[model samples]
Target chain A: MYIRAAAGISPQSSFEQILADPVPVTGSRLQCMEPDYAKLIDPKMIRRMSRIIKMGVAAAIQCLEEAGERMPDAIIAGTAYGCLGDTEVFLQKMVENDEQLLTPTAFIQSTHNTVAAQIALLLKCHSYNNTFVHRGFSFENAMTDALSLLKDGQMKTVLAGGIDEITDTSHTILKRFGLYKKEPFPAGNIFQTGSKGTIAGEGASFFVLQSEASGNDYAQLTGMDTFYKPASGEEIRQHISAFLERQNINREDIDLVISGENGDMKNDAVYDMVYQTVLSGIAHIPFKHLSGEYPTASAFALWLAANILKAGKLPGGIQTKKTPVTVLIYNHYQHIYHSLYLLAAC
Target chain B: MADLKKQIIAQLNLKDLKPEDIGDDQPLFVEGLGLDSIDALELIVLLQQEYKIKLANAEEGQSVFRSVRTMAQYITDHQGKSTA
Candidate 1:
């Protein structure tokens, strides 16, 4: 259950910024504050990788370095829309050439497993490598699978992560489906967006999880579960209790609840329903203003949870009790993919 | 091939290098420009996307992409055959 190490790149700053302070985002769509590539990759190789691939590789390398392991026993990643930028480029070529000729670079790298496979290639790791592509449950699926692997003794140390990207073409395409706000609003006031869509964002995160305890364990990843389209909010509330029951904890014992509150009036009502049902008195924190909305935004939520446990620094605009112990991460996507994660301070 | 150099620089995103920095016969992979296998693939994409010259197989790209001069020669030889 111990998370040995963690690393990520996000819209705010590097994953270490929680120890200091998070810089406020300015635009509706938050773009990642990138690290210098020279520090993490070979220039010759990075020139060929798309942005999402680069981010995933960098974070994976960071995790390996932080965990002090050159080769992990396994690698697992979750992504919803993988390598969209490369896919867009390939599609553009097919459109322009009228199917006369098309290159295979973008097509090859556009697959959902490419992120995990690329990491394995870079690390020369031939262990258990897999990827999950189930929208909001993507990262949670990875976490649950990683824990299962550890529990079953298939592996000892594993590199588990989640990655997703939002490209210009994807932004436009998803906007037609009302996935992002057409008008601009101050990112800090996302809950005040009187709009139909949420801000689009992209990020990648990696965690080194181990079966035994480590010197740098951030927290114990106690439990993870996912529920798809519950019968009603009552079902969701019951499911929350069920997850806690599996972990042998009570609802009132949860010190803080991190909720995915992307501010779409219709889509956010589900989270509101959860609050009214089960998490009314719980100290809740919101992160979509900083990380924005992505299928794997829950990865950022996990990253935030680990940081809170390790650094004990909370960013502004959220309040909590004297000292927190148990944290629950609750996220849902499009009212279809719902996930729950429990973490305890080690 | 002045335009070709600029196209290569922009397409491959050599952020530190400008178009004029590349000579006509400069090698693109490993030694001359420090590009790698992925760049070779992107060069294939460059041919299909920009010049409409499609190499039928990966083996066909080795000589055609040896340098900017070779790439230009391939394009010139396949002038009328371009689909674009």
Candidate 2:
């Protein structure tokens, strides 16, 4: 499939801005720099939407608008935690009211599929709608589904996206488990922190994809593959090699690699291992500094790679002037959900 | 009644509208307030949690939730009844 257009609400103001100058993530968490929803969604609808829903809907709408599409043939979203703010509200109310007198809005909108359903409702397009909630593999699985539909000729255009939001309750609980770094570090030095925990990141990225090229397409999504819980770093390297071989792409064909290194000592070790062996010496850049570390963060990487491929130049802060024709995105969340995406200039 | 309107606005997340914007007898459903079935349910919870009035019959929701006046009347008649 071809990524005709992409839009993301992330920690940076815009992808262009982030590429020009990497934003400094001073704290352990990187929150999405959201756009004003009043300009994108109706006031009536905005009143009821929680933050995550607003972010997801706004990104989807912006993506469709950029594609010049009124409606997509399908809407598919992947989220590890769905409507988390609403979920927190519902549970809090359930406890406070002792299982009685609970309001319905929070309960109604707390489902994992709410984002996809809300997008469909706003578009008034009664097409295929689905959401994947597989913890680390959520976004990759959603992309797989979109690719299947397009390749099968079942849909011409699909709005595929990955979204996750961080709430105070979730952040606190996750921090207790040591998921984020304890001390603050400059965002640009996330990989150099050499800390035990990575940063917490969240974002919503949507892509308008079609089977055929739109001539102004960002990049052609050649293929993507995922592996879960490989026993060793060698196994991970083999998986990357096998994926590239399956795509009929050689290592030399790839002009750049967007590595998912998030500053955690152990996590960076995994990428370091791969870099030493199979992915050695190729132009590689780390993206977790810009996006923070989340289950669906590879979505941000995909958006970055597509834009980089389309622009044929790396963002200013990275300092590479090479024009890349083929880009590889290799990311694994906590060394469990590993994925590779190959994209080429269309 | 004005307090009830404020409560309703707060509960329903009607941020754009103030209590005074909602007329006492204006329909709170389709035509006037553009609320749906979900908002109706929220209003029911509001009555129970805020006024301690448990709606006796679900069928009566149509009349009790018709307007701010009707809701206030329901609360006035049902408060102190220990429905909870």
Candidate 3:
């Protein structure tokens, strides 16, 4: 299936009117500033949603609006830590209140499948409803499911995407576990060496995938693959080679490579393998520095790749010495999880 | 007043302490009260249900939710100010 329309609401300027113009990271520590969700979400519904759910619904609504449709055949979402803030609130309340007089609001909304379920409820969609929570590969797994359903010819249109939000408690937990650095890095040179932790962020990205291409089709999903274990540089190169080979694509055919190069030293080695061995001499674009590192941050990168394919012009902030992108590959690694998505203009 | 504080704490889901621990002057967010964004929204709902205070703007809520002291003062001041 081809991606018809993609919309994202991220920590950075994703859905704002000024988002077309790039805004570089001004500081090392950055967090997602949520959009005014009441515009896309009903006020009554908006009163009950967590930040993650609100972002997910708003992104889905925007994608549907952009596709000029009111309903989809399926709704799927991938979330690593679903409604962490709400979960924390509920847990805290449960423990503090001794489970006596607990409100059902936070507890009900804290489920991993709450976002997709709420979206289905809002749209009144009784179609295929699924949510994936496979750590870092959540979004990729959801995409794979959406693709398989499309291939089976069961669904004509599907909405698939990922979302995750950061909370103070989660941030502290990750920092204590060495996922992020305690000290801050300068914002201007965040992409350079001496950087420790990727700036924590949160957002949601939704894509309308259809079996048939339309005049407004953004990009065709040519190939998608994911690896579970950490691979050696040689092994990683071979995986990319085999993936492209199956799609009849050679090394020279790829115009741009969007890498998940968060400034974390431990995980940056994965990108080194791809950059040095597989995608040598190709344009490499890194988005984590801009979007900040979240579980499904790769969804935003996919959205960026689709926009690049549709606009046919690489924006300034997204450039990594690449030009005239004919084929775009987004390679991402979150801890032990790795994914590769190949997108082409239809 | 004590019952109102207990209800606010319970509704906001601040599970760490009881109404006695949350002093009237204790802050609600970062240092004193330690509530976050989600808690802020829950507090908004609490205000609507308990005091019938309707705030259309989230920015206007910062001062209105400073602490139990501030919330009690606002409820007292705006008891019959508006229909909403």
Instruction: Give the whole-model CA lDDT for all candidates, comma-separated.
Output: 0.83, 0.90, 0.79
Docking band of candidate 3:
incorrect
lDDT of 1 by residue, A1-346 (tens): 7888888889878535644566665554778778887789877667668899999999999988988999988899999998898888888978987874566667888788988988888887899999999877888888888999999998899899999988777888888888888887765688877668888888998999999988678888988899998878889889988888899997788988888888888778888888887787788877787788999999988888887877665666466675677899998888788888899888
For model 2, the superposed segments whose C-alpha errors exceed 4 Å read A186-188, A319-321, B82-84
Clashing pairs in 2: none
List TM-scores for all candidates, in order: 0.88, 0.98, 0.78
* Candidate 3 deviant stretches above 4 angstroms: A15-21, A26-28, A317-325, B1-84
When only the first chain is scored, the TM-scores of the models are: 0.95, 0.98, 0.94
Write out the backbone clash pairs for model 1. Answer: none
Evaluated at residue A202, the lDDT of candidate 2 is: 95
DockQ, model 1, C-alpha based? 0.50
* Candidates 1 and 2 compared by TM-score, better number: 2
Candidate 1 fnat reads: 0.72
Tell me the TM-score that candidate 3 gets on chain A alone: 0.94
In terms of docking quality, model 1 is medium
Give each prediction's DockQ, rounded to 2 decimals.
0.50, 0.91, 0.04
lDDT-better candidate, 1 vs 2: 2
Better of 1 and 2 by DockQ: 2
- Cα error, residue A169 of model 3, in Å, equals 1.1
